[model samples]
Target: MSVTGAVDWDQWLRRWDAQQTVYLPDRESRFDAMLDVVQALLPETLVALDLASGPGSLSQRLLRRLPKARCIAVDLDPVLLAMGRAVLGNFGRRLAWVEADLRDRAWAERLGVREVDAVLTTTALHWLEPDDVRALCTTLAQLVRPGGVVLNGDHLAFPLHLPTLQQAARTLKGRRLEERRTAPGAEDWDQWWAAIEAVPALRELCAERKRRFAWREKNDTPPPLELYEQALADAGFREVGVIWQNMDNRVLMAVR
Candidate 1:
């Protein structure tokens, strides 16, 4: 499933990871915490739905950790999906790349499976609005089997009741992110995309990506942790809470 021999998908994926680190300096640590929770809660052969799974970042790690585990890596971006399919598709049957918009209710139906043991996403769900996220939870409630779980690792905002703390945390995180962006050899988001667009192998895929997401608008602010808790509770999850955190960035867990 790889592209022509001209493109080095491995190198592009590495650059993708580097640019992502500019926003989340402790990205690897967060991934570790998330995988630790998955290992503790699920069986080695568990089936996981990796929503917004850009270039199989979490999916690759989970596959390596569990060996027998399977991941359905879902994303709408054609460019990233192409990269993931090229690089991680070697996992053979253990990993699947599904192209679907998470905001669309029918996205889950395309997975071809009735249920999964866990649904996981990281640093990507923020692209969704609060209502869309709630709707996604409702769909996930049906998709995840009873006794299963959902884990979201991202910057979920603090409650408005803690306004001062929220502002302070946001400022600190912004400062830290700026520092990371200025680090030697760092590639910012725009720079990464520019590089991708400059590559002939990905030109058509990039154009397709633009066509797919051109109508979508990103949320200016991330949804609060409380909103996610309430949404999951309403969606029938038995238990929901933050299992790991660094500043406002946290891993929210919901057990079915």
Candidate 2:
């Protein structure tokens, strides 16, 4: 069966929230942990950047906690960004949307902020090639003020050099957790994309996505946690490491 009904901004926004929980069962917990790191490192008033921000989900959540915060939401996904602006427009003039291709090294200039108190991303960096991820982090570090925090929440796998049995056990646990995460209302990734494609209103944005992002990279495996830790250190950040983790997915924080 196809989900062919017209998709409104709120419909897609709700579906995006539902689908993220399907993949990340502890979505709320992860958000809490990520924000905890932010509030700990930053004050109530904030100048923030939301990287690879899909439909302004994290931006909305962040503003809910710190309404005075100004956030610049950056992403290459036009469809998602459009829905984000349409649905989250009421968050006030504090939210600004920037369409950016992170693969380009100069994407930071588009952010329109000299330095931010916090830079945050969730479940979105893994899509980048490893080098791009490193560059993105380095750019974020540059954008953040001294002592400001750079936080990434993604599926950062453990070191592949570990013993075989230990890795196998981790894999097994991830599978079991994923199985448990499936709920009646949950939509899988493929299903969500298909639903997006079926909506008549989204035809143009769907075509834009196909043109801009149809190519998959040769490597899909995210770098290990150590690589991120090292990248942060090399980029002149201090106190970098994982703050909270479940299975392969983790929230890593670093102070610049």
Candidate 3:
């Protein structure tokens, strides 16, 4: 399947930055959980790859946990890469920000990063088609060294109680309620939707690409967690399991 065409990098960056500043309530918790999983899998310093790493949040958290470990954070958006560099520049020698499409196999080779100890991605990767997902899993298995791990933190599968289409809506509503109680006056879900609508670049990109921007809205049918486990197994990963979860969101880890 054809992926979405190039987006307006500048506009996309602005909107993404605004969205993150407004809605990253559990950022710390998410990062902490990822660190916990990586530490459990690998005892000492190891190379970590953060795929689709927008703004380097996961990379930064990893750096904090493993100061000596090197991190290669990759993404397709140039603007996001710049933002990540700015945010993580303090880690002078520990972090490397790369701009490349995660869907491309050549990207892995280009990075000159032959083997990784752990790979992590959060709130990303679901944008790809099923075929792309399968290819990514296969590539990940090959790139990761023996005893290395891959952790994906995103909405793995829609909850059984709700229809796939309604899942986004339910999640957005729940987020709004939580924000009202805890982060009052903060830009709630409605505000985020409005922000996306107002951004001409995102609006045009969404219309042109037929991609879903709303929190609960989705385009394709997501496979079950078991399906992902099987995919990893086929890819040569020995141990696969969910490390953390909340509703439909989850952090799945697999060891090669």
Name the top lDDT candidate.
1
The per-prediction tally of clashing pairs is: 0, 0, 1
Across 1-256, the per-residue lDDT of candidate 1 in tens digits comes to 2344388889999999988888888889998988998899889899998999999999999999999899999999988998898889859689988989988978888998999999999998888878898999999999999999999999999999999979988899889878888889999988999988988876777888889888777654667889899999999999999988888999999999
Candidate 3: regions farther than 4 A off: 1-18, 21-24, 158-185, 188-223
Of 1 and 2, the candidate ranking higher by TM-score: 1
For candidate 2, write residues 20-77 as lDDT tens digits: 8777778889989988877776888888889999898899999988877788899998
Q: Give me the runs in candidate 2 sitting further than 4 Å from their true place.
A: 1-7, 164-170, 177-182, 218-220
lDDT at position 89, candidate 1:
87
Instruction: Give each model's whole-structure lDDT.
Output: 0.89, 0.81, 0.70
* Cα deviation of 234, candidate 3, in Å: 1.5
TM-score of 3: 0.73
In TM-score terms, which candidate is top? 1
lDDT of 1 at 105: 76
Question: At residue 222, what lDDT does model 3 achieve?
Answer: 45
Compute the lDDT for candidate 1: 0.89
Q: What's the true lDDT of residue 178 in model 1?
A: 85
Pairs of colliding residues, candidate 2: none
Measured with C-alpha atoms, the lDDT of residue 199 in candidate 2 is 76
